[model samples]
Target: MNATAKQPISMNISALPGATTREMLADQPMRMTISKLNFWYGPKQTLFDVTLGFAANHITAMIGPSGCGKSTLLRTLNRMYEAVSNARLEGEIQLDGQSILTQDVTQLRRRVGMVFQRPNPFPKSIFDNVAYGPRINGHNQPLAEVVESSLRRAALWEEVKDQLHKSAYELSGGQQQRLCIARALAVEPEVLLLDEPCSALDPISTAKIEELLVQLKELCTIVTVTHNMQQAARVSDFTAFLLTGVMVEYNPTPQLFTTPSDPRTEAYITGRFG
Candidate 1:
């Protein structure tokens, strides 16, 4: 959706270590937990000692102002902060009761996929775009099966089924976003993290992604960061509100939106201020 066409993803070696190993991650259980977590970039602390739990097979949305650290916290969950040279973290983040900080980072990411704000498909053919993750992780299965199943899971198979070999650039912006989702799903991640996934799409495309998210929660835990209250209310089972790098409130989506306990949350949701 951005002006630039999708570019081939570059390998992020820094985010690869401390993750579960290839073999171990494939066998991980369903639970994912975050405990007493704190994060900082050099001297700038972003997250406080935040502790929270996400249920298996549910959708959790993180909402807050632009600089409230929602995205920072999401990146920390999957060790995306590792990519930054001066980033520092304290406390434990676990997937299935296993501390992710102690696991092989690459494996952790493979088990936990992320979709960014913009639709960023690879420059390659559509099939290759979805297949990239599995190929990089050394999946030996037949390529056709991998691509088809992944596309189906991402809810993009039918739309792109006939154009599998075409360059991802040719697809509509919405299709490219779904293709990105398919690329993440290809590896069969246990948890999917979406950061403002619908920010770049039009209203119709945004609705499609929301519908797909509901379907995705049946298979994996989903944690999304969004600035849109309507989108969070529409898709998430739970919602967490952050401000100035602190979690002000976290509750079931219905309660958070309709009867938030914190006055700040109420004001933010009521359009007083972000």
Candidate 2:
């Protein structure tokens, strides 16, 4: 792809009045879909009847105020919520038109990799950290090649190439985050879910990660939960706004940021309230 060429918008899902989620995605090629998803932690419902589609090879960002269900919804995509005691979900989630709920949990995770808010690199060497997933999944690919390819994809290979055997902890915060990303990419997931992946990094690190994400979208779909609206606008092709567990608006990134259809979305983005 030409670096200067604009990416063709696959769907015209602007934030138009009365537009339904199904209508928004009707013509797009979706890598994942969520239908009437309702989730709860014990008796407190956190998500309510949310429906959305993630376009293949595109980045979709979920943005909202604190305590909104952005992270909760992201977790549902890979069944990460299963770790929370008393957590339960109702509704259907599909990847490539197949119900993900019925798939093996282990396999589902492999196909839908996740990175959390903080960079939680393993205590082992940098090389071993990126190689962990492939080893555990029994991938027979050459480990050295996979490590190099994954690091290169994450935009960290050049920085860490000579220090492959160094502990992941030795890297700066930004490098560690990119290393975590390399670990996720090693498995060759079809969808990558990130929850505030840049929250802890400095501006330069954040920019590198943002650039890496743009490049990675050519290989996989990406759904990220970010509190920073600017980051969402800079990196995502689509943006979804959630308020108090309800989907307020979802549209192409430019439209949602500039001319939001919902008053709540407008207020939040304009800094009137969160």
Query: Please, what are the lDDT tens digits per residue for candidate 2 over residues 155-205?
Result: 999999999999999999999999999999999999999999999999999
Give the alpha-carbon lDDT of every model.
0.83, 0.89
Tens-place lDDT digits, model 1, residues 42-70: 99877776766676888989999899889
Q: List the residue pairs that clash in candidate 1.
A: 16-106, 17-105, 18-103, 18-104, 18-105, 19-103, 19-104, 19-105, 20-104, 20-108
lDDT of 2: 0.89
All candidates: TM-score: 0.88, 0.92
Worst-scoring 10-residue span by lDDT in model 2: 1-10
Error of 2 at 230 (Å): 0.6
Candidate 2, after superposition: displacement of residue 26 in Å? Answer: 4.3
Instruction: Indicate which candidate wins on lDDT.
Output: 2
